[model samples]
Target: MKKIIFVDSTQIGLFTFQAYILELCNLNVGFGIYIETFDIPLVLFEKDASDVVRLSIDESLVQFIANKSISSRIERQQYFNQLLEFVKSSEELAAKIVFKEKEMEYLADSKYLVQMRNIYINSGNQA
Candidate 1:
């Protein structure tokens, strides 16, 4: 079975939260995690397992988040907490989740916002 976490990149601390989730998935060997960007779908992280967890983020969402004029650290933290809860919920939903191969392939080939390349590059360096 496979589970997916849809992330709104406009939220703050997204990279941090994603890193945290990836680490959690790493420690828990039962699940394998992969990251899918709006354009290119990359196996940013993976593990051997019978189940998969996909972190899906859109490039446009990242750009929107970056362009936002007003945001606070506290709000970002709260959003992160919500995401954590969503992940927990997804665990229970994993069994019921269904995905088609064609849909997955389309996601892999989709286009993403090119303006946020620097952010991704920076995050990659930090990782």
Candidate 2:
């Protein structure tokens, strides 16, 4: 299992961080649920020789703010304040994403079944 170390961030940055985590899951990378708080530079992920992946929450927040063009300092401060309320660690977030992905897959499969049933019914009408 690959160990992923994620820097913590706010709710505003959660979605973007979740995307990266989900991608890592798809790649079959494994990470633990340990949460550690500290000051670190902005980065997404770094892989070392020991197969440890480090993710920086500050980097994710910066990217999200830049992408949204949040120029106002007040809005930025609000995000920072809300960070205290964002509780889930990286592993938990990844789990949620995986669960949601599975749910969507199931829905898609059901849709295929419905389409097949419709096709069968239409063929019977034609016959």
Best by lDDT: 2
Give the worst 10-residue stretch by lDDT in candidate 2.
100-109
lDDT of 2 by residue, 24-116 (tens): 434644323222232222222333345444333343434433455323445444443443234234434543543333211221223432442
User: Which stretches of candidate 2 lie above 4 Å from their native place?
Assistant: 1-47, 56-64, 83-88, 91-127
- The local lDDT score (0 to 100) that residue 80 gets in candidate 2 is 39
TM-scores of all models? 0.30, 0.30
The deviation in Å at residue 34 for candidate 2 is 20
Query: What digit string (tens of lDDT, one per residue) describes model 1 on residues 1-127?
Result: 2334443222234432221122333454122222333322222223234444343444544444444413344454454345445444433333234322211211223242122333343222221
List candidate 1 segments past 4 Å from native.
1-55, 99-127
Tell me the RMSD of model 2 versus the true structure: 19.1
Global Cα RMSD, each model:
12.9, 19.1
